[model samples]
Each structure stands twice: as C-alpha cells, then as structure tokens.
Target: MSDDVRNIDDALSRITAYWQPHRLTSINDYDVKVVKIHGEFVWHDHPDTDELFMVLNGELIIQLRDRDVVLGPNDVFVVPRGVEHRPKADEEVHALLFEPKGTVNTGSAGGEMTSPLRELP
Candidate 1:
C-alpha cells in the first residue's frame, strides 16, 4: 500500500495464510498488520511492547493465566506489555494487529508456527 487511504478490510482480503502477519503500514517503529488465525496460538508475551488486537470478523479468545478476554467483531483489546497471552479461535478469525516492528507472533517461543513478516500489497 502507498501513502494513501487504507481500508483495513481491503488489506486483509489480500492475505491467505493463517498465523502469518502481513504488514499494513508503519506508525513510527510499530507495524500495523492483518492476519488470519485459527486454533490456539502459543502462550507468550511481548517483553517491551504492548500488543493490540482488533477483531474485524469472527471471534477471539485472549487466554491469560487467570482469565480470558473474549472479543467479537469490531472489538479491540490491548494485551499489556509483559503479560502472557494466547490467542485462540474455534473457527477462522480475521484481525488487525498493532505492535512494534519485528515483534514475532510467537514472542520468544519460536517453533514451526513462527513466520517471517510479509509485506502488504
């Protein structure tokens, strides 16, 4: 995307991979990204930056050690820095994520689920 008007839905439509982040744009050093997620993600936490999740479609459960924060379409949640979170979905979920550039989806717990960042169209 150029330095022009950006529609979140339009950007998300270009993505076909689950658990991978496609960079939508940058706000300072942070990357605005869109991703499709299914099943449960690894439990991890950003040691330096807060992670933002905006549910655009379907539902998401931000499972924490003590509680779960459920989000539906049009809902937003911020997992505070250093707090553990595992994003889970029973079905497909489309979401917009905002976090620092180079932040991995799996945090420090690298595994097969880890994906290299992809540029947005």
Candidate 2:
C-alpha cells in the first residue's frame, strides 16, 4: 500500500475474515484496520493501548466495566487501555479499528479471536 492511499471502501472489500484486521493506513506508530464483526467478542483489555471503534454499518454494543455504549452507523467510541470491554452485535457489523501498530485485538487474554499479527488481506 502507498502512503498516499486512504480509500476505506477499497480497503473494506479486501478484508476476508471475522475479527481479523487488514491494515489500511498508519499514522506514526498507530495503524487503522478495517474489520467485519458479528456475534459476540471475548472480554479483554489492552493494558497499554487505547482502542478506537468506529462503526461503518449495522450496530454494535460495547459493554464496558461500568456501562454500555450503543453505536450505530458512523458512531465511534474509544475503550481506554486496561478498561475491560466486550463488543456485541445482533447482526453483521462492519467497523474500522484504530490502535497502535502492535496492539492486540484481545489484549493479554489470548484466545480464539486473537490474531497472531495484523495483516493486509
């Protein structure tokens, strides 16, 4: 990918799996990843990195340690690092995730949803 390219639509189509992220673009040490998510995700938190979730389609409910944030299309929220969270959607949801380059999706609690590394589809 070229540094000048920033077409999200083109990046979305290239993504091929659930929970898996396709590197879209990067700003300094952070990278944006386009992901397609459905159902429920495991509860976890990144001890040293904040996670930004931007909904592109459908809806999502982010369950936090204290409250839940409902997100619709174009809605965005950030889960601060070390704050436990779980993402759920009644139907298929497309979202753009932003975090530092080496941030893990499932944080320290590696399980089924954890990807070895972020890759471009």
Candidate 3:
C-alpha cells in the first residue's frame, strides 16, 4: 500500500456536505470516519459494536433514552452498543467517528441517515 496520506482538513474540505462521512484511517478491525452533522438524527442503537464520537468543531448533543450528553470541540463520548440514542445540533457540527468496519451509522434502526461504506480522502 502507498505510504502517502492526507490530513484531516483536506479530508473535511472534500466532504463539505452534511451527514456524509469520509473514511479516514483504520486500526485493526475499526475504521475512522469524519462527518459533519446538523439538526437531529433518528434514534437508533448498534447491537454489535460501540461507537466513539469526537467533536472536531462546533458542538453536539447526544440524547440517550433517558439522559443526554453535550459535547464541544475536543470532547469525546462513547456510545455503547444496544443503547438507543440520537444526535442533535442547533448549528453545523463536525466530528470524528470511530467504529468497527461495516458498522452502520444508523445502527439497527434504518432511515435516511444510513451511510454506505465510502473511501476516505
């Protein structure tokens, strides 16, 4: 494989659109994706794997079944699999997501927010 790689900003620029995630790098069985989020997402749960969300810019609020967690820039949260949750943001937000390869963004609940596995910048 080629050793050359691009930086995060370069990747973000290519994926300026919202909700569409651009695959970055992967470690072992996990893949890293960068996505721009806005508004609210559907409630869902991943029964097979945990998801890591790292805020890169703006802010995000993840609403669980009972409680909610607000994340700002440089903040991070881990959503355990099988727990229903939804993400919301008043303004545009940017974040880095880490999950196992083939892990659907929408998890068990399917909707328009579901994303296909895509290549990174």
TM-score of each: 0.92, 0.91, 0.93
lDDT of 1 by residue, 20-61 (tens): 989888888888888998999998988888999999999999
Q: lDDT of each prediction vs. the true structure?
A: 0.90, 0.86, 0.87
Model 3 misplaced stretches (Cα beyond 4 Å) = none
**Top model number, TM-score:** 3
- lDDT tens digits by residue: candidate 2, 13-121: 7777778877888788888888888888999999998899999999999999899999999999999879999999989889998999888888988898898555665
* Highest lDDT scorer: 1
lDDT of 3 by residue, 20-66 (tens): 77788887888888988999999999998889999999989999989
> Clash number for every model?
1, 0, 0
Ranking of candidates on TM-score, top first: 3, 1, 2
lDDT of 3 at 69: 98
For model 2, the stretches where C-alpha displacement exceeds 4 angstroms are none
**Candidate 2 colliding pairs:** none
